[model samples]
Target: MDIYSKAIKVFGKETQLIKAVEELSELQKEICKFLISRTGNVEEEIADVKIMIRQLEKVFDKEIIQKWEEEKIKRLSKVCEVVECAKKN
Candidate 1:
């Protein structure tokens, strides 16, 4: 198994889920700090969150998550198009 899968196997799903929450919280704090001071380890926090998110994909339904991601991307694309059009006007 991959490292992420190995981590999930070594640590139970519940523990990993809690860790994911903690990582997300840390990322949120880092973002807030970065916005306030233009200084913080946001990139590192993002990497941590990404790792936890990958583990979460392994723990849950990846296909469903992928579908939702696609839908959200489509919605974001439409919003971007609107913003771009407004910018040109």
Candidate 2:
């Protein structure tokens, strides 16, 4: 098992879930600071959130998450196509 899997196993799902929420909140805060002041550890917070997301993928059904991601990407592609068409017209 990987380090994330090991950490999840040792820490329990509830604890990891809470940690994920905390990491996401920190990332949000960093993004807000960067938007307002043009300065914040946004990259570091993003890395932390990505690490927590990886742990979450291990804890949950990764396949289901992947399916959702694919669907969202497809939807986004459609939106991009519409925006591009508008730009041309």
Candidate 3:
């Protein structure tokens, strides 16, 4: 099945999860296409691809994004690399 079908299977209704899952699904399709087309699949290599797919599934989680940004700021602050955060207005 293609990305759209897989997305609908995963998220049946038109909700935020549907939107997020569709985007992730499309990304997975692209990655899978590239890897399969370019390198050809190796067994362990395919396992790594599956791990990346799992990560993609969680990409839309707000808590994950928040923690990533928090860690980024902390690291940059220590390195004196802090600039200004993007302004909303």
Off by over 4 Å in 1: none
For model 3 the TM-score comes to 0.32
Tens digit per residue, CA lDDT, model 3, 2-75: 66445545765355354555555665666687777864335545565554444445545657877997999999
In the range 18-76, model 1's lDDT, one tens digit per residue, is 99999999999999999999999999999999999999999999999999999999999
Give me candidate 1's TM-score against the actual structure.
0.95
Model 3, global lDDT: 0.57
Candidate 1: 10-residue stretch with minimal lDDT: 3-12
- Which residue segments of model 3 deviate by more than 4 Å? 1-14, 39-64, 72-89
Model 3 per-residue lDDT at 20: 54
Model 2 segments beyond 4 Å from truth?
A: none
Estimated TM-score per prediction?
A: 0.95, 0.96, 0.32
